[model samples]
Target: MNDIWLTTGETATLLGVSRQHVVDLCDRGELVCTKAGTHRRIRRSEVQRLFNPQLTREQEKSLWLHRALMGHLMLDPQKVLQMATENITRWKPKHRADGIAMRSLEQWEQVLSGGVDVVVDVLTGLDEVSSDLRQNSPFAGVLSDVERRQALRSFREHWDHEHTAA
Candidate 1:
C-alpha cells in the first residue's frame, strides 16, 4: 500500500471531490504527482493528508507556542519581524543542504516580507503548508521566557485533559 498510486478519479473519489478538482490541486502544487503517460498519478499518502490535517503532538505543541508568538506579533510587529529575520539568517546556513527545510525557510522569508497579516496567517493556519512552516519556524525566542513556559504548560494540561477524556 505504501507504493500505491491513484488516478485523478480515484483520488477524487477518496477525497469526495471532483476529478477536475484533484487535477486542479496537482496543478496548484497542493498535491504532488507524477505523470503516467497522459494521466497524473497521486500517492495515497497525499490524499490521506487532505483528509487529515491534524498535526502530531510535537507539532501541536509548536503551534501552541507560535500562537503565543502571534499575540506578541500583534503587540510589536516590527520587533517580532526583526527577531524572525535574525533567526532565519542564523538558521539558513544550517539548513542549506536540506531541501525541504530550505523551502520552508524561503516561504517564511516571503511571509515575513509580506507583513504582519501574512505572518499571522501562517502562524494560525492549519493547512499542510502552515504545519510544515511551523515545524521550521524561525520565530524562536519571539516570546519571552515566561510566556513560552506558560503557553507550553497550558497546552500540555489541555492536551492531557483531552486524551484522558478520550
Candidate 2:
C-alpha cells in the first residue's frame, strides 16, 4: 500500500496499462487519483481493487501485492507494445496523414475542429494569453507510455539535426 502511492508509473505497471491510460482514467473519474498540475498521485487503495476485486485473507495480509512482485519484476512490455504500435500509429501530423495544406494556424485549428481526426496541437501568437483549451483532448487517441517516449526521442533528434544543418 505504501509502495503503490510511490509513483504513477509503478501503479500503471501494476494495472497493466500506459501512464496516459492511468491519467485518462483519472480524468474520466474511472480511477481514483489526486492531481498536482500535470503529475498524478495515486494510492494503493485507489489501484488495488482493479488488480483484484475479490479479496482473500492471505492477500489482505500482504494487502493485495501481486505474488510476482515478491519475485523478479515482469518482463519489459515495451517490445510487445512497440511491435503493436509499429502498425496502428497515432498523433501523426495532419499533412502526413492527408495531403492537406498546413500553411497557417487557422488551417491547423480548422483541421482539428472540422472533424478531421488527428491529435491537434495549436501554436498561437498568445504570449501567455490563455483560453479554455485543455492540453488533453477527446480526439487524442491512446498513446501508450512506451511509444510516446520513443516518438519524442526520435522526432526531437531529427528536428535538432535539421535545425543544426540550417
Candidate 3:
C-alpha cells in the first residue's frame, strides 16, 4: 500500500535511460511494472531497488570507516598529526625522535592529500599506529583497539573482495 509510484517516463528519467529502454527492462523482468490503462506504472520502491542494491555487512562497514576517516582527515588533519606525533615521541625517544614522528605524520598527511594510490595501506598503517599508541602512549586509555581493528578489518575485507584497478 505504498502510495508512491512512478510513470514509465519518470522511471526512464530517473534511470537515465530512454522510455523504450525502461519498457525493455520491464519486458525482461529486470524491472517490475504494472499496467495502468494505456501506460505502465512502476512502484517507487521497485525503482529504488533496481537503482540501489543492498551492500554486504563488510561493505557497509568499509563505507562507514572510509567516510569517518575522510571526514576526520578533511576537518582537522593538524590535530590528528599532533596527536600522532606526541604518541610517537613519547613511545620511542631517540636522537631524531621528532624527525621520525614527523616523517610518519608527513606520510599520513600525504595519504590524506591524495598522494598515495592505495587507501588500504593508509588505513592499515593507521590501525598499526593506533595499536601502538594504545599500548605505549599516555593516551592509551582514550583510544579503542576494538574500533581500530574493526576499521582495519573492514578495509582489508573490502580490499580482498574487490579487485582494484589501481
- In model 3, residue pairs whose N, Cα or C atoms come closer than 3 Å (at least 3 residues apart or on different chains), thus clashing, are none
The true-versus-predicted C-alpha distance at residue 9 of model 1, in Å, is 15
Q: What's model 1's lDDT at 107?
A: 88
Q: Write the per-residue lDDT of candidate 1 for residues 26-133, one digit (tens) a residue.
A: 999989999989999998988887767777898888888898887778898999899999998988898766588888888899999999988889898878778889
Measured by C-alpha RMSD in angstroms, how accurate is candidate 2?
21.1
TM-scores for candidates 1 onward, in order = 0.69, 0.30, 0.35
Candidate 3 lDDT tens digits, 1-166? 3458888888999989999999998988878999988788899899888656555554445444544455454565565545555654564554354665545544544444453233334443324343332222222222357766776776776776774565
How far residue 126's Cα lies from its native spot in candidate 2, in Å, is 47
lDDT of each: 0.87, 0.43, 0.58
| Candidate 2: tens digits of C-alpha lDDT, residues 1-166 | 4654736787789889898888888887778888767688888887876654542332222221212121211243334234323323333353443432223323334434433122112221111111112222221223445644555555556556654555
Q: Which stretches of candidate 2 lie over 4 Å from their true place?
A: 1-4, 54-166
Worst 10 residues of 1 by lDDT: 157-166
Q: How far off is residue 150 in model 2, in Å? A: 55
Better of 1 and 3 by lDDT: 1
Better of 1 and 2 by lDDT: 1
Model 1 bad stretches (over 4 Å): 1-23, 26-52
